[model samples]
Every structure is written in C-alpha cells, then in structure tokens.
Target: MMSYQQLLDQRAQLEADIAAARAAERRAAIAQIRRLMSEHHIASHEILPRRAARRARLLEGEVLYQDPVSGATWAGRGRPPRWLAGRERELYRVNLESQDSREGR
Candidate 1:
C-alpha cells in the first residue's frame, strides 16, 4: 500500500503529466488545423477569446489568425490592431487600480 505522502506525490506527478499531454495535444491540433487550412485555401483569422484567463487579463484579447504560408498575422495590415491585442487585460487592470471612475479613456 502507498503511504499518504507517496500517494500525494503520485497524484501530483499524474497531474503534471496530464497538463503536459494537454499542451502537446493543443500544439498538434494547431499544426493539423493549419495544414487543413492550407490544403483548402481557407483565409481567415482565428478569433479566440481568453475565457479561462483571469477576467482582468482577458481584456478583449484575441489571437489574430496568422497566415501559415507567409507567417504574417491576420487583419490585412500585417497584423491586428496593436491596442486591441490585449485591450481586455488593460481594462481588467484599470478596473482593479481605479477604485472610482473619475478619469475616462
């Protein structure tokens, strides 16, 4: 039988392994999707919302779909709006720092 400490250690190891596997899966999925897009000539940016991220850090953040062939980010101008990239995170910080809204953006 495993001791309590040993069991805890095993649990931690399993959790870590699971997390690593999930990251690998995400990377693989990204690659496969890119290949499919290329094969099909799909043109569009991926607008992913940071749902799992901290509400403060998520400020309107989105992963602009990048061109797989050219390695340039989407949004036609060689990338999405710079400020829009992490607007959500900024908003979260502002909301945290400003107790009362006296200043307006």
Candidate 2:
C-alpha cells in the first residue's frame, strides 16, 4: 500500500537503526571488557599472549675436527661428516695451528 519512495525511505531508516544498534552493542561490549580487565587487574600486554620467535642460527664457532689430507673441516655440530664415520675422533681433532691460521695467526 505504501508508495515506492516511502518503501525506499523505510528501508534506509531501518538500515540506519541497525547500524546504530550495532554501534551501541559494540560500546557495551567494550565497556564490559574494560570492567572485567579492571576487576582482574589485567594489563593490555597480559591480555595478549607473548609470541615465541624461532631462535636465529648462530655463526659457526671454532672447528672441532678436520681431515689433514683433504683439509675438510667440521665444527662438531649436527651429523659428523661421512669420511669421519669409522675414524678415531681424536685423529681428526682440529689442531691449534689450523685454528690460528684460520684466525690470521
């Protein structure tokens, strides 16, 4: 029974009412959250969880083992080199001379 313009106006008014209601709801929620935070003595930082970042790979430190003949080096980290599998670890121990040379000695 309403005119087209009246129907359009009603729809616009309804949309505005919905928007206002949503705004009020959001305000209420924020007020409730603030109250809860104050009641529990919760800080903003405490509300959010701390992120644990992956540790970065460090610089390779001093070498622990080496092959004198081939000059291959290992820092004694991770898996041992294939050539060192059956050999005595002391036999492949990195000498002070090699370390010093690497350090510009």
Candidate 3:
C-alpha cells in the first residue's frame, strides 16, 4: 500500500541503518581485541609473525629473467621457474630499458 517514493525512502533509510550497525559492530570488535591484547600484555609487533617481515623484505627488486613465449618474468632470486629449466638464463635476461618501460619509465 506504500507509494513508490515512500518505498524508495524506506529502502534508503534501511541501508543507512545497516551501515551504522556494521560500523558499531566493527568498533565493538576492535575494542574487544584491544582489551584482550591489554589483558595479555601483548605488543603489536608480537602479534605479527616473523615470516611476514621476511616476505616484505624479499618482495623488493626487479625481474631478471623472462619466458618470451609465456611472458612470465622472474626476479632471479628464489627457485627459477620450471620453464627455465635446461635453458640458458643469459638468453632470458631482461634488459634495463624493457624493465624501465614496463615500470612506466
């Protein structure tokens, strides 16, 4: 029995209510986490594992080799891609100009 405009307004109001509820829930969850951290005297750094720190450092640097056919690139740091097996890495070496161009030089 509601008019079209009334139904639209109701929908908008419901959306706003849902957003407010979600924000309140997030704030409550964050407060609970803070309380738990304080109770255990846990530092923020202690909450983060050491593997993440290592990964953050390792992700830097540039691609050293590439597969010309598949366009797959490797930074030449960790294990070489299987496609590179039995092939000369020098043949797949990426030039500085190509690397710079790809990075929006």
Per-residue lDDT of candidate 3, residues 53-90 (tens digit): 65654486667788999999888887889999899999
Candidate 3 Cα outliers beyond 4 Å, as residue runs? 53-105
List TM-scores for all candidates, in order. 0.44, 0.45, 0.49
Q: Residue 19, candidate 1: how far off, in angstroms?
A: 0.7
Count clashing residue pairs per candidate: 3, 0, 0
Residue 2 accuracy (lDDT) in model 1: 96
Best by TM-score: 3
Candidate 1 structure quality by residue, lDDT tens digits, 5-102? 99999999999999999999999999998898888887544333355343433343422344434444332234444544654433323332342333
Stretches of model 1 off by over 4 angstroms after superposition: 45-105
- Pairs of residues at least 3 apart in sequence or in different chains that clash in candidate 1: 59-88, 59-89, 60-88
**lDDT scores in order:** 0.56, 0.80, 0.87
Best by lDDT: 3
Candidate 2: which stretches are off by over 4 Å?
52-105
lDDT assessment of candidate 1: 0.56
What's the lDDT for residue 70 in model 1? 46
**Candidate 2 residue lDDT tens string, 1-100:** 9999999999999999999999999999999999999999999868654442111111335677888888888877789998899889998897867667
